[model samples]
Target: MEPLLLGAVIVAAGGFAFLNGFHDVSNSVAAAVRTRALAPTVAVLLAALFALLGALLGTSLAVFFVGAARGLPPGTNGLAILLTAVVAASGWNVLTWYRGTPSSSTHALLGGIVGAGIASRLTSGPAMEGAPEGFLLRLILPLLLAPVIAYLLAYLAVFPATWLLRHASPARVNRGNRMAQAVLTGVFALGQGLQDGQRTTAVILLALIGTGSADGVGIPMWVQVFAALLLAAGSLFGGWRITHTLGHRLVHIDPMRGSTAQGVGSAMLLVSGIVLHLPLSGTQVMASAIVGAGANQPFASVRRPRVVRVLLVWLGTVPATALLGAVLFLALSPLLQS
Candidate 1:
């Protein structure tokens, strides 16, 4: 029974990573794909490889998830709660992907775990207590603020990026920026993998810890490899609608602007994941960067309505996923407890 449950948990965790590849992964490479800086096949493949490398970069995000996992009550109740969170988060990921909305997988997962924690406290008393305490300071606030930071950084980067090539010809700048976009997009994809890849790996590790199959403290290397590969597979076959929405609708005038957004997004992800040890949303960062890149030109050049829709979608993700997680936990608690 324990082994089966462990397998189930690992599968659920992989599903989330797979969904992330198609949905959130699209954001990491959208600019490069849209601007023709890299072919779609090449871009996705590049993202997949780089994402794998990024997964191995460090495990801070994985450790964070483990902290959340530790808060879960041990035994069947804990397993059920963790499973429910994965299902709910994955469901949200599928829904958002079908709608072509660039929502945050991080937000969905957070909602899931938090919702599960709240539900567990109600269902089983003190076992689940204090589990959700550190999240606000560690995860939620940083997630909420990351997009704003990405927008500002990307927006600020545009003028300087453009200024550096002020003396260059349009053709020259375009070609050069295309090359730069390809490279930066690859780096961004790696960062995306680093931030998100460790996340699912953490979930799997938490499950192992909960089940007494492994120590709760460390994320095994095999788990990291598996998560990275699954995520990359998801990216390779990602939905193009998401790519289209972010690339064309938001901003993709040329390679230069696209490069500006992607470059900023990558830099932010690197800092957030590696330096600050935050599992910030790559989707949020990319989306905001695109808007910021658009701001480099006249306001009319940007699609205000579309941007509004995207922002609203991002804002709605947490609440929706949280509710889903809470509801699923309540519904399943009675069944799984016995």
Candidate 2:
């Protein structure tokens, strides 16, 4: 692979990481800010710092994601496929953020890879090997199961959280929960970085492997640093549109319930990304948890219209990005091949 092409791949991957942080990690702080647990600026700053820490400290997810790229076409063709996938995922992320809908960045990238690989095979006779089966068992199964699990976990958690604080006065409960939520939001952001940062690392690693610049045994230190910094930088900017949708439009909850939802969401990310090495959408997990916690409370009610809208967008994300990826690959094929 040419130096220019490799550089292009790295730049594209960086952009995707940035947008992932912007669209997804920023939401981790929404509940904290919404419940007045933390000031908006302070929450954002906390998220940025922890996300950077999580990215630098985590490596298991990067190793797992790289396995998914083993089927890319070798050499420059592989770089093009990777680039198109990142662009497709990034584009979809921006659109959803602008529309104020929460969608899964994980699904978008997976779908993009599938679409680009199929498009490449149709035109050039090479596709992502074992894509359908691998996606079903490894990616889709976990993603499909995660939100349901997150919802249930959050719903059940509310019972215990509320119970423990039942003897306390409302003012005391509110004050204590605010402090708890501030901490939960930081943990949430850390997990977000741990999960999303590895994605960028995997993309850049694939680029290097395609160019024969590095063996694919492990992630390079500089790649991790670059990915970590870019992800954190993106978090600094934040995505307030979707944050509003999550914090205000989707559900209403007190500080205790908000903390419950964030706590559940944070635990889900840590367990899935680290323990199981599974890919999950922080956006989807947190959104579902919020709804789950909100619906269970007698004083709280979910906004059905907003819920439906967000759900529809979530369901459409993968297929839409797949088509987008295929189209992008086809349009850029000549340049990619040359």
Q: Pick the candidate with the highest lDDT.
A: 2
In candidate 2 the C-alpha lDDT for residue 73 amounts to 68
lDDT of 1 by residue, 67-145 (tens): 7556677766777677888898999988877888888888888778778778877785435656576764777778888
| Distance from true location, Cα of 31 in model 2, Å | 0.5
- Give the root-mean-square deviation of each candidate in angstroms: 1.8, 1.5
TM-score of each: 0.94, 0.96
- Model 2 segments beyond 4 Å from truth? 131-136
Q: Give the Å error, residue 109, model 2.
A: 0.9
Q: Could you tell me how far off, in angstroms, the CA of residue 100 lies in candidate 1 after the best superposition?
A: 0.6
> Which residues of candidate 1, in runs, are more than 4 Å off?
1-3, 125-127, 131-135
TM-score, cand. 2 vs. native = 0.96
